[model samples]
Target chain A: MKVTVKLFASLRKDRFAVDDFDYQEGATVGHILASLHISEEEAAIIFINGRHGGPDSPLKDGDLLAIFPPVGGG
Target chain B: MESLKEYLLARAENGLIRLSIQAWAVQNFGLTFPAAEETILGLNLLPARYQRNQRSLSCGQQLSLFRSKVAVIGCGGLGGHIVEELARLGVGNITIVDPDTFEEHNLNRQLFSKLDNLGQPKVAVAASRIKEINPAVTIVSVYDAFTSRNGSVLIEKVDVVADALDSIPRRLELAEVCEKSNIPLVHGSVGGWYGQVTTQFPGDYTLQKIYSRYIGERGIEKDLGNLSFVVAMIASIEVSEIVKILLGEGSTLKGKILSLNLLDMEFSEITF
Candidate 1:
């Protein structure tokens, strides 16, 4: 199963902006984050194929997973 | 008063009047500049002072902006720039709330802060700067922090609110107040080279969704610090959202957050 992963804001500092990952069948968003070395706390918002997704949400092949860190300031 | 109206009408050239007519109306009729401008617009006459704005905004839309009132919470990095833009855009009334004084640290990103104003209150400087930018804008500076107790009174008369605050708890509190007041809020935040903006209406739960896990935690901005360009960029976006709301034009980021990363030069929009 091939999934395209995208990271935004500070999440991309030490991580690649976009990458392709081959995961096992029925892999959850949490599993992807763990594999990318991104802590669940660091990924504020996650979207799967442009729809809001949670860590427990499962990702299918050819899905686009987007992760963003909380950019909170004034 | 009838004679003054007649004088203004006589000054009109092809149904378009110059700002001098507004000045005359203000002096003779004892009407404020904005009041005079609105009366002129109501009579289907256009003011020459708004000639530039007429290109992008219709005469009616410009009048709407002149009649709208906005409240900006916090007078630091974001608040300073937002107020500057709003005044230049001719928002009739602006209520600025902040209790902090400008220190040396604020010189980096605050628009109104200067070496001479190091000890001055942020709202006071904002008021002075607004006056210099557009005297037609009436600014009411509240040199107090925006807490739940004072939020209602401060924003009761504003058509919209801009959340320029740096604290998450205060942002959440302001969202609750806007919900009760039924006013739309334009929210923007910046950290280092990154920034995010969104618009929240009553019961949208947008801010809560963004700050869900970090409600009590401080933002990463504390560690990375804010960049001047990022603050200006986010503040400008917040002002644009307010303008759209005032004119009732275009789609707002009501339920979505637009995040920008200057380092990566990437912009992303997420809807929750």
Candidate 2:
């Protein structure tokens, strides 16, 4: 399956927003995260389909994942 | 008397029990502030006696009620922690300004540093992090360094400002702008396992005075020490001062500078 990965902050710096990526059909969040090239320790928080969800959570075929880096504000 | 103190702390909202259970207990009890005295008092503890932490931190809640605008300039080691604290504490609106791209070195403690974010712009990363923490908050990011050109505009936009900058020149510029705008500003820094913070309202204490009086004019040292924990401590202190400014109680560091050497855990405050 294919998905659109929108990255922000440091993640955005690495890749532009709305990047196209391939994911396994009904991919578990873990798999989609892997496709986005993010690691568990480095993952700040993952949002599936614009809502907060855990990593082990599953994903649909065309889910939009927004990934952000851990943040400390000024 | 306890009710008076609550009023003093600006717990003006109805029923002002907004204070954490711990702090409410201490405030209501005649026992001294933060009293070791058993709660033998408030927070739903009927006539029964109880012992627990005391003092009012409800300042954050009330401060949020006023919905002050704050600008946090930076999102790395110091900036990262500041953002997290402010979001959870519920500041009305916060604008973050940072132009640097996330780097590998930031991983040790920079809030937004992750292997996946190795090259992401800090401002956007930090902005998204704020959203995750408190979506209700308004967190805007300027993905550029705070140069003299844009610095003043940014200062003009926010009601209060916080300086978590790394360089002395940048810090000075920010401080001066805050002074000109008459905005309350909280300043913090970390180096060699040491961190210090100060709250300066307009016409109070200029950043220059604090820097030269204590830390000196040196820029970055050859090898900076652990900054994670130090930054966190300084940030919380910064947030506390912001809370004080918001709730309209407690003395701020306006005319004072607080310096800490985390190595031996020694802290001193100097008035300018």
Candidate 3:
């Protein structure tokens, strides 16, 4: 299965902004973050196909995953 | 009242009343400046302070803005700018909350922070600044944090709340308070060149949805260090949302988030 991954804000530093990669059928969001060397803490919100998804949420083939970092500041 | 209206009409300059003239009315009629302003706006005459807002906002809309009350949480980067704009934009009543004093580090972005007043309370400085900008505005300065205990009272009579807090947990607490009170919250946050804004109505739970996992008191901004322009931009957007809410004009970021990256110049509207 293949999934499209998009990173935003500071998460794009020294990393690809958007790309597609092959993952196992049962791959989860946490798996993709780990592969990208991003800790779960660094990924604040995750969206799969424009809907909120969790790190433990499974990704299906042709899924478009987007990850954003926490930007809470005054 | 008829005499005052006639005087205002006679003194009007091209259907606009100057603040100095309004001050004269306030002195003669023994009325507050805002009261005089309300009378002027009621007569469909524009306040000179809001001259630039004309055409963009009719006299009726300006009157509504001058009659609205808004609470701004935190007096840091976002809060300072938010108060400045709200005051200049003629928001009648403003409640500013912050427990901290101006620090050396805040001078970079906090609008009210200056080299001369580092140790002064943020809310006090904000109140004075609001008066300097627009005396018609009534300011409520709170010298304390917006905790769950005080949040309800702080926003009890407010029509709208702007979240300028820096802590995730505190933002969540504010959201809960506004939700319980059924007040709309215009939320903005910044980190370096990145910022995001969203308007959440009562029961929306958008804050909880966006901030549930990040309750550690801070976010990426702790490392990124918020820039001046990012804070100002997000603050302006938050104020715009507040104005829209007050005047019932234009669409706002009600059910979506506007995420901006100044470095990349990318703006994305994400719906949740």
lDDT of each: 0.87, 0.63, 0.92
The candidate that achieves the highest lDDT relative to the unseen native structure: 3
DockQ of each candidate relative to the true complex: 0.66, 0.03, 0.78
Write out the backbone clash pairs for model 1: none
lDDT of 1 by residue, B1-272 (tens): 37656877788886677867788789888888777878777777777766677679777777788889999999999999999988887788899999999999998899999999899999998898877667788899999999888899999978999999998889989998998889999999899999999999888988877776564455768779999999999999999999999988999998899998888788878887
As a whole number from 0 to 100, the lDDT of residue B25 in candidate 1 is: 80
The superposed Cα distance between candidate 3 and the true structure at residue B67, in angstroms, equals 0.7
- Candidate 2 lDDT over B170-269, as tens digits, reads 7777877787777888887766555667787777654655343223333323244446777788888888787677767788887665756566565756
**lDDT at position B57, candidate 2:** 42
Please list all clashing residue pairs in model 3, or write none if there are none.
none
Q: Is the docking of candidate 1 incorrect, acceptable, medium or high quality?
A: medium
Per-residue lDDT of A1-74 in model 1, one digit per residue for the tens? 99999988777776788999999999999999998888776777889998987889999999999988776678
- TM-score of the A chain in candidate 3? 0.96
CAPRI quality of model 2? incorrect
Ranking by TM-score: 3, 1, 2
Badly placed stretches (over 4 Å) of model 1 are A24-26, B13-21
